[model samples]
Target: MKRLGRRGFLRMVGAAGLGWLAAACGAPPVPSPSLGSPSTPQAPLEVASPPPPSAIPSPTPTRRPLGNANVPGMYVRYFQPFYPPTREEWRLEVSGLVERPRTFRFEEIRSEMPKVTREARLKCVECWSARRTWGGFTYEALA
Candidate 1:
């Protein structure tokens, strides 16, 4: 018997692997059936009607108001200011086994770090949420 070269051996191994895979996932082929003659249609049946009521009762009289029902109309109160605090005033402090631990302002961090924008789906505990496009620096970059 002759020994196979590197390329020939690889090709034979690949072919055997494919054959094994095919055999492992093998399923019997379905046979096609011959066309038969068409059958005749049937007629629709009619439904019966329900019976009527025997005796009807007399209607009751309406009740009168108890006391004086005069009341004043109240207006709903509205507040003026609705906007939240600015992100520029936000601060984040990190402390650990490091040479320096400092508190960073939002503007300071934004100016120092290279920002990356990413699209992600945020799911709430209530099973309702939205996809948000957020811009932030990674922990490695921050470190």
Candidate 2:
């Protein structure tokens, strides 16, 4: 998939933030029909209405010790379960119907390639996203 440019990315982020703020502001609760007084003088059921969105206090923002590093949410939804391979045990294999096949260890790639640090947004298909500063080396850097 084609990546979005910084300007387009920032626009999306701003729009999302505005949308969150609008949602947080919330809609006015409609009064229930049963809330009206009965002409027959029936005993009124005291149904407790939930507090307004504004009444529910929001969590205050906290300061992070590590700059631009954001941890993933506590609850994660993944399509498939897979064991993560550690750098010490993992090797990248580059083999295909080609003239030469090559294999590189994780440590080799880390030591040999030029690394890049970038601020990126991790957006889920569910419309949830988080921005963080990521540091990694690209495959192109190996070339």
Candidate 3:
């Protein structure tokens, strides 16, 4: 048996380490052909054609009533007109526990003072109200 010195032992360890490293980092081996020549081309595979579309049955006709059978001659109205009273016919009366209580026509009130218009909201105690731009005289003016 031969005994290796320190330098020879180090050299042998380094060679074994390099061989293991090479084996771990080596590229994959090329594949080999088993059945035929690698350069030969393969024929394309054939598939059967799909079956023809089936004939669809026609739909049957449905019968329904056209309009209301009970009311035949009924017709709808579209427009309506609104008419207001004339200035001569307009009147306002205030009568209560007061010394200056009086009744006056619209013409007499118009002649007494200038009219004032205002916008106000009338709210109810039940938490519901409507907003409106009112055009009318105040309580003092009416009084």
Maximum-lDDT candidate = 2
TM-score ranking, best first: 2, 1, 3
Off by over 4 Å in 2: 1-75, 79-82, 97-100
What's the true lDDT of residue 140 in model 2? Answer: 66
Candidate 2 versus the native: TM-score?
Answer: 0.41
How far off is residue 104 in model 3, in Å? 1.2
lDDT of 2 by residue, 1-143 (tens): 88999999999999999999999899888998888857564787788999999999999999664443445753477799999998889997877864567888988887887889998877655555668788988756644
Clashes of 2: 0
Better of 2 and 3 by lDDT: 2
Query: Model 3, residue 41: what's the lDDT?
Result: 45
> 26-125, model 3: which lDDT tens digit per residue?
9987766764555644877678787655645467786333322332232434498558789877766788876677787877877776678675555544
- Across 8-51, the per-residue lDDT of candidate 1 in tens digits comes to 99999999999999998988766545435555558666676654
- The pairs that clash in candidate 3 are none
Q: Which candidate has the top score in TM-score? A: 2
Worst 10-residue lDDT window for candidate 3 reads: 65-74
> What TM-score does model 3 achieve against the real structure?
0.32
Q: How many backbone clashes does candidate 1 have?
A: 0
TM-scores across all candidates? 0.37, 0.41, 0.32
